[model samples]
Target: MSSTPINKPSALQADKASATTSANLPEHISLSKWEDSGFEWAGQVASRSFERLNALLTTEHLQSDLEIKANLYRRNNVLHLSFTLTGEVWLTCQRCLQPIAIDLTDDYDIALLDNESQVRLVGEEQDCLLLDEIITEPAPERLLPLKKLVEDEILLKTPMAPKHDDCEMSVEQFGEIPEEEENENPFAALASLKGKL
Candidate 1:
């Protein structure tokens, strides 16, 4: 949501403290900024917007702890950013369909757009990071929704078949194979008929 992206301002070029205000962030998060890093916040993403993940993965509670660390490198309007996200989500087990709590700690490498351009489509969404400057930036305190990302990842990790390997069918359900059926072959049955005649 920040157009400026974040950059390491030289001591002489540092912008006034206005940028560090809590007003810059959405109400759900608590933010703190670090030098050479943008902003870090830990909280939930959203209930309505993330309904898919909510339905697919049963959260331990409606609440999840999400953390994002991001920083940008800007030179001549070219911006590069790196993010590290950490969080946890509850998922159903593939085998038993039991509750499984999965933790997420992932690192994302990306580049940010310097300004609006026809190339906006190059990296305009969550799937891909845009191309801008040649420099690769890896900074903590990035701006990413860690909770939602982990939720999706956990959903993906869910197994398609939900049968537990250790489970067994009851004896009656197992059913016995008929020994007489196995001993008799069609060819053998024909030979016995010839002897009888």
Candidate 2:
């Protein structure tokens, strides 16, 4: 139902209102501008590696090495945003407590709305966000933070408990081996009593 224009350069410039450093990815965007030019972004952002993931990541300062694309275009009075991310990231393996590479790739289609109540006006069945087929977000100021949006998608894809397919750690370290228990037959005691009788 929706399509994103790929490989188009971004016309958006840094905003004077927001404080930004060179290290930070594009943070905020005006939805109006996006709709006007049909914004497109594709590049690798190294600053957003595993180290920047806050408490979700255990290791720090690993290679970011991520490729991302974000496309925003308006269609039929509705604003749509399509995002895709792909790369390899290191995550602390739960099994061995060591860094393991995890393939990161995801894509989402979002239908933008001015407010939450507008969903009622649009009728329930048409909402892409509610159906989970496409995401919908409220745009009160028509401005959104892109950094958070991209980071959130990556975080959602992050493995909650990372582990390697062939774990190098010994089984003993992962779990305790079950000890064998001696079996005693209750029938043996009953037979001994019957013989004495």
* TM-score of each predicted structure versus truth: 0.41, 0.59
Report the C-alpha lDDT of model 1 over 43-139, residue by residue, as the tens digit: 3343324556566565444546455454443333444444555675566566555656555567664444434463453454523333323223344
Model 2: residues with Cα > 4 Å off, grouped in runs? 1-24, 47-54, 58-61, 115-141, 168-197
- Which model scores highest in lDDT? 2
Q: Pick the candidate with the highest TM-score.
A: 2
Per-residue alpha-carbon lDDT of model 2 for 106-171, expressed as tens digits?
776666665564465443545244222222355555566567667766777778899988887655
Each model's C-alpha lDDT? 0.44, 0.61
**Model 1, C-alpha of 91: deviation from truth (Å):** 1.1
- Alpha-carbon deviation at 105 in model 2, angstroms: 2.0
Error of 2 at 56 (Å): 3.5
Candidate 1 shows a clash count of 4
